[model samples]
Target: MTISLSKDEERDFDREIRPLAADPRCQRMKRFIQHGRITTYEHSMNVAREAFRLNREWHAGADERRLITAAFLHDYFLYDWHTHGDRLHGYHHPRIAAENAGRDFRVSARTQKIIRSHMWPLTLFHVPTSREAWLVTLADKICSARETLFERGSGAGHR
Candidate 1:
């Protein structure tokens, strides 16, 4: 079955996702994007889009809301991992993102787990248990890494 959001459903998605994107915790992310550093919004959208692509390609029957929510908010912490001092982001940001997400959104248990465990083999120490969670995690990594690399290359000669 091909599932796609209608215009009204897309509007609802924007309404639901925008508040989280506008939160104070997420402000740092917005600022980064505004400064042409890297875009949390774009990165997030890419992850969600990529996840949907993967699902369509693999014919994976995943919950669309859970997958999209997890993909969009996976890096809700909005901190620059490169400046974490001791590289704590690999082991810390997931918890921070999860806590903030819990406070801001009525996240499902599975969605929360995906947010909390997306940093697998690092802080999570375990892989995501659900297909939706796993898809979000993989999408997050793919998007984040690509963005990070692009930013690094573009900024290499400037700094």
Candidate 2:
């Protein structure tokens, strides 16, 4: 679950991603745990940071601003889904996140699409239709898997 960025990457993160991620509501995500030992805020930062690195490495044509913004807001469901009593959290959080992000930030349609489709395959019909969306999806899975499988119990808490 460690987000390892080089100096230049850190500069990129600070310059490109930190401002929006510093939003008050976004900061509140620090209170909620995502997978295993990571806070939702930490997880979102990891995703966005990684997405930016990937975009640089791959020249993937994904819009950097949109990708970072969407990554930060992809899990903006704003609650601990594990304890929310929602039976369909996996299928539903993406849309909830999309709505909340749009309402709060006036994100573009492309960013909304990235947030709404990041949990694809589990979300089934909501396939990623853009390069940025696909990168967010892949980054989410990688970060989630690493957090859940390799970093479990360091700070894990029960719902």
Compute each candidate's TM-score over C-alphas.
0.71, 0.91
By lDDT, the best candidate is: 2
Candidate with top TM-score is 2
Task: Give per-residue lDDT, candidate 2, residue 56.
Answer: 77
Worst 10 residues of 1 by lDDT: 150-159
Candidate 2 residue lDDT tens string, 1-159: 457778987887788777887789899888888876678988898889888888878989887889899998999999998899999998999999999999999998878999999999898899999999999999999888877766654365545
Clashing residue pairs in candidate 2 (N, C-alpha, C atoms within 3 angstroms): none
Q: TM-score of model 1 relative to the true fold?
A: 0.71
Report lDDT per candidate.
Answer: 0.68, 0.86
Give the C-alpha miss distance for residue 49 in model 1, angstroms. Answer: 1.4
Per-residue lDDT of candidate 1, residues 60-89 (tens digit)? 887777877787787777665565564666
Q: Which stretches of candidate 1 lie over 4 Å from their true place?
A: 1-28, 33-36, 83-86, 152-159
